[model samples]
Target: MHGPEIVTTLLEMADDGQTRPTPSDAWHLFLSGLRQRFRLPSGRPLAVIAAVLIASIVGGFGAAAGSWAAERTFADLPSQARVEALTRQASPGDDYSYDRSTSAWGTDTTMGALTVSDWDPASARDRFAADGWQVTTVRDMSAGALAYTNDPATGSMTPLPVRGSQFDAVRDGVFLRVTGYVSPGHGTVSVMLWPDDTAAMLPLMLAGAVLGLVAGWMLAAAGAYRMRPLPAGRRRVATVLTGLAVTALALPAFAFYVNMTRVLGPSGSFVNTVHSALNASPYWSYSTPRMLLLLTVTGAVLAGAAWATMGRRGRSTPAADQIPTTG
Candidate 1:
């Protein structure tokens, strides 16, 4: 109980493996350490954190913008305005020429003189319903019935790594061509030039950003986040960046799941064409199932990371016990 004895005891505890700090003490130490390491006021670290988050999150969005803009260069996206202009310029004697600007990513294809006896987006929905085909992509046709599974209602995005036909168009009651992606798990049934009105892109973007940050942070944190040889500021950066990276990664995927109204859709045009083609050939098959595996794995990772984020307050915990270190 003497002052010198108390000093000896405290020094022992500081260096002792078994000694543990109380939660409150740990919190104070953690904050003081963080401030000293980051070389900023307590408030400044939060601002710095927000900046990285914005970079990773908003930068991820740049992926889509970049995708759309770059894709537009090679493949012109079909514009409603362009279609309208063509519809007007053509006379009864002249068949209207239309185009399906599926993705600015690629493919700038125009339609067959695809004369439109009538063009209506509203009536098209009715025609789709009558055919037992739901309106996945909600674009009105100039003169045919076409719909995709991924709704183009919510956002302007194409399903990740688009699997099957990217668009659908039906001409003259018999001619149908639906184009989309056919990736490993899910395939696409692109009814319009874009992806789901569903929010897949946002999450995917975050996943990419988080992945980048996690990777970058790992390199930094391996040396930075520790109790020894204090890399101090870099350590704090690693920690904050890590948290920001994780949030960036998980938020987007969460948005997709919470809005589970949409699925990776297939094209009704493809379905009808297959039916018609089967009537003639009697045998053919091209099927793609749920990207659920990717979704599942992604969900597991994001869920685990999110869980870790919630639990990881004011201290570092070894993660190997909670989840896999590598994907």
Candidate 2:
């Protein structure tokens, strides 16, 4: 029978009170129905098993490839040097040093200190402007510092102003903040630079992974439904169990294969190690586990419902055959 007709029949039997069976009974009947419908070459069952494994492997690898591509794209974003050059130009005579610099696949941030003998906010702003940096605002360090707070409830810290004069600017895609502090004999300029694109890239990476997962599941399901059906009187419970196993195994198998092939080194062995690359992968950490559980439960429930419907149909058929015919 066609996929839709089989599914519809199962659903109708599930909805009909007389035919509705318990979850376990329904699953058994579903497996029996599948066996009967797909009774082709004797090797049909084995082929279905192989198809599920192949589908899962393709799905897992496809997700991994897409995720890696996203990371590579993010890595191509503009670097902090784009802003640092402007800072150097703004404070030519000052001795400059990077206070802190951090980088990830999609983002980079650098904070630098410039030691100068004099503090001239106006001259600094003009210098930055001449170098194509658009001055955003100039404010007293004390006023900016007032915005800093430690939230007791959340235990989160907000940005605090450095001990100096504050200047904010934007050039190209970089956000720059320059703070100048003047003492009796010493003055210091602080430069902070960040790219605007990092904020948007993270969400896109996560979204891409999710989309890949869904596409994989649909492909596997469709392939399974369209394959040759199982033979009649095949062990109903065994068939249902095998389906469940396939559903559960496909995701982890895909995850393991991808992780081992892509993340592990040539010398690396997949022995008794508890750690896996999938666990470390940002995209896979949460999504893979949840998808595995959801798919397994869904497969079991569907099988049970299909089995129950088939059993109801079987019992009703015999009774109908036994009934007296109108002459």
The C-alpha lDDT values of all candidates are 0.35, 0.51
| Model 2, position 225: C-alpha lDDT score | 43
What candidate 1 gets wrong by more than 4 Å, as runs, is 1-18, 40-113, 116-125, 135-193, 200-327
What lDDT tens digits, residue by residue, belong to model 1 across residues 1-327? Answer: 123443344455564474776687678767965554433223445544543543443333334333333322232334566444423322121333445532111223333233332333334444544555433454322233232345468755443332222223332222223332333343322233322122233344345445544443333322222313334664455455455555544444332322221222433221111001101121213312323223334544643453343332234432333332346
Once model 2 is optimally superposed onto the true structure by TM-score, how far is the C-alpha of residue 25 displaced, in angstroms? 33
Q: What value does the lDDT take at residue 101 in candidate 2?
A: 35
- Over 1-327, each residue of candidate 2 has an lDDT whose tens digit, in order, gives 344444455555575465656788779978976555433334456654544454554455454444445344432223457445656655654666764432211234567677776677778888888878779667777443333457788899764444467777776666677777765455677777654332333244344445545554554343344332334544454345546655664665455444434432342111111113333224254574345445545654654554443332111132333333457
TM-score of each: 0.26, 0.39
Candidate 1 least-lDDT 10 residues: 271-280
Best by lDDT: 2
Any idea what lDDT model 2 has?
A: 0.51
